[model samples]
Target: MNPSSDDTMHTLLIRPKAGRLLFSLLCSLLFTLPAHAQEADTARVKELQGVEVVGRHVTGKLRHDSLGGMSLDLSFLDDMPRIAGNADPIRYTQLLPSVQTSSELDAGLYVQGCDNAHNGVSINGVQLYDIQHILGIFSVFNPSHYSRLQFAGSAFTASAANRLGGFIDMQRPDTLAGRVKGELSVGLISSQGTLRLPLGGKSELILSGRGAYINLLYGRWLKVEESAIRYSFCDANVTWLYRPDARNTLWLDFYGGNDRMDYQEDGENYDARLGWGNRMVSMNWEWKRRGLTLRQTAYMTRYGNRFSIERPDFRLRMPSGITDYGYRLSLRRGRWTAGTDWTLHSIRPQQPETEGERQTTTLSATRRHSTEGSLWADCRFAVARNMELLGGLRANVYTIRRSAFFSADPVLSLLWTSGYGQFRLTANVKHQYLFRTGLSAVNLPTDFWLPADERLRPQYAYGLSAEYRTDLIPGRLQLSAGLYYKRLCHQTEYIGTPFELIYGDYDYRKNLISGKGENYGLDLMIEKRTGRLTGWMSYSLGRALRRYPGRFSGTFPAGHERIHEFNAVATWKAGRRWSFGATLVWAGGTPFTPPSYFYLQNGNLLSQFGDYNSGRLSTYIRLDVSATCRIKVHGGRESGLNFSVYNANCRHNDLFWRLKFNNGQYYYAPLRPLPKKLPFLPSINYYIKF
Candidate 1:
């Protein structure tokens, strides 16, 4: 049971004689995983001729999990192994195992219990609270017309409602049949293109765009010392569909994103140009009379981030914004599914000059309003014919206005399946009123940004999960294991109140406090998706701890608590037209604080963090490689020539947290230095379709 398939080993170093790139890598290595249904309704009409639905992956209507816990499927990408923009589906879920990718195309992913606003993102289904387009490292949907991807951890199901450890769902793509497919790309780290058309008939039209420049490719290493940084970003999407017939349907979605950063510093060593962004719009509808089946959706979102930091002497300006909207309805009855959703939020953080400010300076800003609601039910029955049963339930209501707070969260689940795999038990009581702000002292953004409290009182969690799936060999061994325990009542962070004083870059004075936190985890998977050498090996063991009591390192162990994670990937098929792939990652040392000691206040220098993740750094592994070559510039087969090589071990590995005032000795800054090793980077690409 070791199929480990991916990029299905296509080898054709340089073809000429025919054999068509070795039959397109054996039809993309005939995908492996997710087939059992009596090997798909009786081995496909006894072998083709009048049956269709095997565009790879052993046949598909789409639904996969070759032992890759927390499922995601877009027909499972024809047979996997396709990475070249559109955040490669969040970089293939960062090769799983508690996910990790703080930057380098960041969506701030550091999942192993959670943090980064505590996981929650959705697309076609709505709900997308700050999916980030930049300034937090990439992600804001643009996977060139995706079509379903889901991830849920921390006891979720009951239709996954309001906050707690994990959730990501994306859906879009199914343009009334086909025709008009597109893909255009350029790279240094950013560039994308997608288009699909087919309107009339049942209705359809799709468009996508993406952009990034980091000052046009690093802009000479951000100018160091002189302290110059430049950034740029963008995202756009449009979708429309109205199927007047065929049961009934209506859908419309528009998305937007923006990010800008310009900086200069030398003498006063500080200047600024900053901007933040997010915008969303959505609508969904569907109906199937009689037997009953319905779906209705709604969405609206807005987010703004503004900043100003200068220094002739010193100056700061901060502006923040937030807006949210929601609605939901779902009914299926039969397999069962009933739903509901309501979300409302408003947040504005404003900074009103901190008087004479200096002693190492620290400023303050905050404004907020909140409301959250949820109702859920989802089910799938059938206890025999191979086994099946999936349950659900959800209820959440949270609010905070000025200082009067409120919260109520409830969630539950049950899963059990036969077909050689599947077992589940989940429970949740999640909640999170609001949080995110503060990290200057080198965390950059030149100090100024706060918002948490319209009375932020909603931090609840009582989770438990037990999941298992197995198949160590029938069509190839695939395995998944999950165990989680969550117990958290309240958690928020940021402290220093004395009137919100934040003197000098290091003067960190006065009050800036917020409290509560906890997380627990364990998830593992082993995959070999079929023949010609496949890929996948993962591991994750987690814990996130935090409890603030007033300040000065009140309680710690939450900076994306990481305690061992490993990943391995491989690809082969070097015969017909040449194909190659490789990946390796290992983690175990993520918790940092090296600023030693400092004191100055008023003008800033009050950093004294000796605890909280106590310091650990020395475990990270890297190795990446890709090679593709196929010849055929006509009709189908995607018209040849594609080559890629990234970090083939350029292995500089360190992207921690930096702040080492050098000789001036502000020391305690380090993040972005994985130079323990390096080498290998080559790229070449070409693809044409007509």
Candidate 2:
């Protein structure tokens, strides 16, 4: 029995069911009679022409948003507490109740028990493949270049297609008209600068750049004998906006970034080097008239990495990457929106080459190509005096190696507002055409992207959620609580042993396995949005389970599952020149598979694991605090000095466990133990605006 065939049948059966359900619900709401009917008199209609209903926008605050998501501005993220002189977007999002990280040293986000690869990250309508820098410690997004970030844990809009887990969209700031402003900042690890300049009367340009000098600092002050390590990273972005008339606008954007690391061991005669980067360029045009808006975008993006190791007599090099080219067109009028997007993907898996003193060998795999296209439409309207309904549909098609797959998904959201409280219900279906395979135990740059083909089918998910939000103190305090459930199909994972690469087995396709997953969770938050003190407290309880067809028939904990999570954040303005902030995080242990026992086979010692993700790591806890002081400069300019401490508690949180085998005995050793040394780090930075 082929899994792909089963998946195709299942998709065909579910599409019509989901469509009928959404259509029926929408029809019922649309035809429902109002409590009070108005007379069909022309005089009364004319007299009521000036009357209008006023309420919050559909995409405003999380509590008010129909989709039950969160939105954060750049100002909020910039002032949040951070670690290692890094204040990137992903780090801040990890503090949210519905988001979780695999470990302290990993930057990948596991939203609502979904795999990190299942989530989608986009910037200014362009998708991003490489979102991390410095091996997942920081994100590639430069805070100075973006204006706002939005996240959805479950249900998503029709415009956000082809993702099953969650959605994260980063929007660029609007054109800064009639303004010439910029800022410069210097931190312990990197330096950054930004500038916004108006060009003539109808155009503007913005540029930002950042570079790290950690390698220079280490070499100059903290050099170690018999060993050397070097690492550096840099990123830059440019945005150009032009408005020829009041109703027409154009935009051109570019981004480039890279990270490199090199290590050497003199005693062992070993040298290793790694480098990865991304390049993207996009063009957009928009036209608006009356209440209608039309926009079109074209973009190209590439992400790739290279790794090499050199020993005394042999050397090896591995290279892999992916490239995407796409275009989108969208139109919006009042309460309705429609759009279409088409993208082409090129994937290259890692190919390794080895060179020895006596022989040279090379192993390679064929590159894969695929195409994806989607069309979506949605609208929002009032179903009753105090209720609004939003419904959308998307049709997606993917073609790889001459094989085509189609999926039709439906999304629905309803919100009821009464006084200062709101209730929301949402249901959505999503599908994905690409999957990633690599080592799950560690975060590495060698992961490869693979497209769905004849043997493998696309992944799909069904999500449902209900939420209630109320203002506890009118304009000052807000509270929200929600529950969500998600079911996933046709998920893929690598099932081969981790040592395959050592034996020159570079073909990962053979080890692929298909499975299913289910996740359910509760999210709660209390937030203060005004006054001198503003922050939020969030908590989440969740469970995630997975099962394979034959080999892991019984459900097991997913790799990213956590039973409990809690976060507290606060910022206070002490005086005109001083501000302080703090953040605390506690989470239940992450699940992992440990070796249940070991045996000798054919005079060789081997290890066997229990059920997948059967063991749990130690719980994780961290505290971070920050303070900022403002200084008045000449010409009324201002500068700020920030000081921060990460891991204030000095706890030895274990990142992972490594099994050691010697003399028919096995022992477990902890990696990245924090308590043995002064892992607590303090950093200071200075920023000036002109």
Candidate 3:
């Protein structure tokens, strides 16, 4: 078949077929019923009582823990205000004081001065590389499938290694041992469904899926031309749990998601297409006794993206992907825990295929295969009646590009409980061997991954933190304050622009540079945990500086650094059926590079940049509001309707600025700045439960 025909087949036939198969499988699992339905229902009541007890214990742990992490329940997210009515975990986490991004349009997370690549995100113990669906607009995680979400700023647990900045972990719900239950939801951007079924006495299944229909709505109702633009995404999840006895349990999990975007310009004779997705499978087993507990897990994960461009005379295709196979084992006795993890990584950074009448060739810049392993041990002990101590150690080994690298990390923490309050001190060291680079300012699918080699060494960091927390009114109000400092080495940064790489050279390594960074900050938060009116207020003051000896000797602010940040969130329960929420945010301007001057060279205008990150964008401010109403449905069921308004005050927060040059002159007129931003948007959603 011809090239155009082949492309059409893949887009129209293959994708739809795969999507149908996934949807069918999920539906079958969700609707399946047990042979002895009446018998199962009789036992479900007793099982539900036990589940409630376990839930209470988990909630208490979150409320009283001194680890300095944020814990959120899925129910809380349903009532929180969001953009476009999309309930995303990452977006909710970004509202915290310790996290910052370049702008509202950027999905990349900058945690405690560390870049997004330095942080790790996991779902059910499996790592994820690409987490966004439409560039920076929405996240791939389905809120309907998650039970709890947690985030740690600096000092993470030993189980989460190979990262320098921080980690985010999401947990799926356990087996629902009660009667069958399901929920269906419809919104402006997407639709989702969830079901939980009890198979028998010891087995249970849960299934969920979400898909976007924006393209269909636009084409049919809005009368949009089909050939102009197109975009869509879908994701599905399945989990099964079996508990044969009181001491042993087993679980199986599967997840798959995909996204695609296509754009065409008739006047310019240009076409561009981008596609990316992730798939994961895992199995876990656990056994517990009086003093000993053991757990094992095995999993496989894949992430990939493809970009293509075609014109009258030129054609190009670029593909990149990463695959991982991993296993983990852990044991716990009393206050001590030990674990080991082994993983094999297969990475294809960038492979370009060019076809034309004059030249046809396929080339790659960096393709790598590697193995990574880690062993860790940790312990917690009570030193006295009021004092406690915790310590851990980890050893890591990485084999990359025919070479091996090894490192050791240590963590320590001290806690003291007094009559007035609690105090904590922590110290840790971390190391990483993997990195990602992107040409666009936003977190797009075009980002590529690379491993450490002779020229590019691994990255490491050292961090220290101290905090004090107190309760003002026992269960009504609380306050926490912390101070932290971190030093990072061998951090990677992209120095060349996207146009330079496309028009000049495709060698990405030659255009990359490494540097060192330092960050110091203070954080303060005041929270009201339980009441009719509940919420939190937080403020952060920080500075992040970087130095690259090879390129420049002077230090400059990091691209994502903000000098000051403040956030306030509140929710009010007006009555049994009415609830309202509001969020307000303000932050300092982000730093950028400004042009020094313009010059004429051979009838072409060229510009030079001044010191790195010397100019600043405008200050950012935004407010969001939401309201929810509960209604009674048939068969004793419940339903809800949610309405939200983003940018309620109509603030024109700048996404980015464009630089304009005057008529063919090198230095004759002032440069004009054009701003692009998102305006006020309103959205609504409805959900029914049975």
Against the unseen true structure, what C-alpha lDDT does each candidate score?
0.60, 0.78, 0.76
List candidate 2 segments past 4 Å from native. 1-64, 219-228, 264-269, 356-361, 597-606, 633-636, 660-667, 673-675
Q: What TM-score, to 2 decimals, does candidate 2 have?
A: 0.86
Writing each residue's lDDT as its tens digit, candidate 2 over 603-687 gives 4557878778888888888888999888765664669888888888787677777665555555676666343546677888888
Determine which window of 10 residues in candidate 3 has minimal summed lDDT: 52-61
lDDT of 1 by residue, 1-690 (tens): 123222222211323433454555455447433454544544532122232222224211122442223555543422233333223565666666666545342455556556656676768667665565544443667665677677654435566666666667777765474566676655565776767677767787778888876566657664444467787888888888878887788988888887788778654466777787678898888889877889888888877767776665656555666777878887886777778887777766544343233533345545556666677776666666544556566666565653544444555445555655667676657666665555542123323323335444456677777777665764444677777777776565544432343243323223344566666778787777555666668788877777777463466777656677778766666666666766777776667656557765555546555666678666766665666666653454354444555455565555566544433446554455222232334444454333
* Best of the candidates, TM-score: 2
Candidate 1 lowest-lDDT run of ten: 46-55
Error of 2 at 3 (Å): 50
RMSD of each: 23.8, 10.9, 15.2
TM match of model 3 to true structure: 0.85
- Model 1 local distance difference test score: 0.60
- Assess candidate 2 and give its lDDT: 0.78
lDDT for each residue of candidate 3 in 1-690, tens digit (9 for 90 to 100): 111110111112234555566566566556554534656555422111111111111111123256667677766766777666676778767776678744665666788888888888888778888788766666777877778877888764566668888777778776555778787878887888888888888888989999888767653332112236677889998989899988998999888999888877444577899999999899999999998999999999999999988878778788998999999999999989999999999999876677766566668545688899999998989999778888889899999867899988898889887867888899999989888886754557788888888788989999998988876655456688888889999988888764443345466787679999998898888877666777788898989899999797699998788889988878888987888988888899878777888677776557788888888777878788999888765675789998988778777766544343334433433211111233566788898888
Candidate 1 has what TM-score?
A: 0.29
Model 3 Cα displacement at 368 (Å)?
A: 0.6
